[model samples]
Target: MTDLAGRTALVTGGGSGLGAAIATALHAAGADVVVVGRDEAKLDAVAARLGRRARALTCDVSDPASVEELRSRLADTAVSILVNNAGVPGPVAALTDISVEDWDAVFDVNVRGTFLLCRAFLPAMIERGAGDVINVASVSGKRPLAHRTPYCASKMAVIGLTSTLAFEVGPAGVSVNTLSPGPVEGPRMARNFRLEAERSGGSVAEAEAAFVSRAALGRMVTEEEVGRAVVAMLDMPGLCGADVDLSAGMIA
Candidate 1:
């Protein structure tokens, strides 16, 4: 891993789960980290664990004004790393059964939020001629995941956004990439498994097995592994315009 001794990182959705894990990894790599999320208590909890090198900031990534406020708050800080991990899992139902509002909400957070953050932060990096951005998408975007059309579509937009933005910004020295993980065993997946079981009339274990069986590894990746992969991606200077899959051979 690269020794990010002088870098500063800002992570969205860095309160719990994968976001928290990524922030922890970046902190361990010697980067001063700012954990951003809607929950002050949760963000504070994460920052507290990282000691003086970390701080919490509150923001709604989907709201433009919220992002602007966050940018103003961080005017004095130089964030060299931006992790756009804030997302929402949309409704688990057939396309015809899904409501328009439900579909819009998913795109608002997953796609719009990523776009807003990048729009807010990328300029400073461009001016400085150095930065890294990892938009946390999912393998579902690249492949197929039944009953999650909104999520898959939104993530696919993020991937496309990253790829195009990378080419536009690489000449200016900033690197933009997407990190797509497969099934990471966590509260999120647990909830998803329960939902799948209810929909399929199967046990939760069976639902989980059905999903894991698709992966060549026959297992799920951990949040910690995803975090480590983020660090590894940062270490590679030439990795611009790429969507790196840490999917346990699920997409391989």
Candidate 2:
């Protein structure tokens, strides 16, 4: 658990769900963790669970100004690990049904957010010649997800960024890897099921079943698995420009 001792990690959207889980795992691995999100209360709650070696800050990853402010705030802290976990699921509807605003909103957060955070932090990591950047993309990025064009496209963008950024920063001893998780069980997914059911005139159970069936394991991955995977990837010093799928065999 002390594998990351003496290191500092900054996790965006660390207030809840996968982000919170990742923060906890990093903290457990002995990294000083800074959890950032739009919700102060949720961030505080996650910080509380982390006890020592954890603190909370609020920032909108999609906002350049906010990210710049965050960079200013962490000027004294050398963030060795950056987890771009903040993302929106976007509207669960066909591309034609999804509005321009909805589509842009997804890209702004899922794509632009990752870019802003990297722009704000990568320089220091390159200067120091040591760091890890994990972008939480989704399996939807590689596969076509029905009725979720915006989400799929945005994630693909993140995936592309991870690989290209790794190639750019690897010489500086920085590792940039994409963590693409499959359908995860949580409120977000529950809401997706609700919307999908409403769209297809099917029960929520049916909607869930259809999605889960795509995974070879016939089950969704858990947030903890993802958190641990982040730790695992970080532990591997040679891992760079890699898309590690923790999706329970959702290869189809």
Model 2 Cα shift for residue 198 (angstroms): 0.5
Provide TM-scores for the models: 0.99, 0.98
TM-score of candidate 2 versus the correct structure, residues matched by position: 0.98
- Model 1 Cα lDDT, one tens digit per residue, 139-168: 999898889999999999999999999999
List ranges where model 1 is wrong by over 4 Å.
Answer: none
Worst 10 residues of 2 by lDDT: 1-10
lDDT of 2: 0.94
Number of the predicted model whose lDDT against the real structure is largest: 1
User: lDDT of each prediction vs. the true structure?
Assistant: 0.95, 0.94
Model 1 clash tally? 0
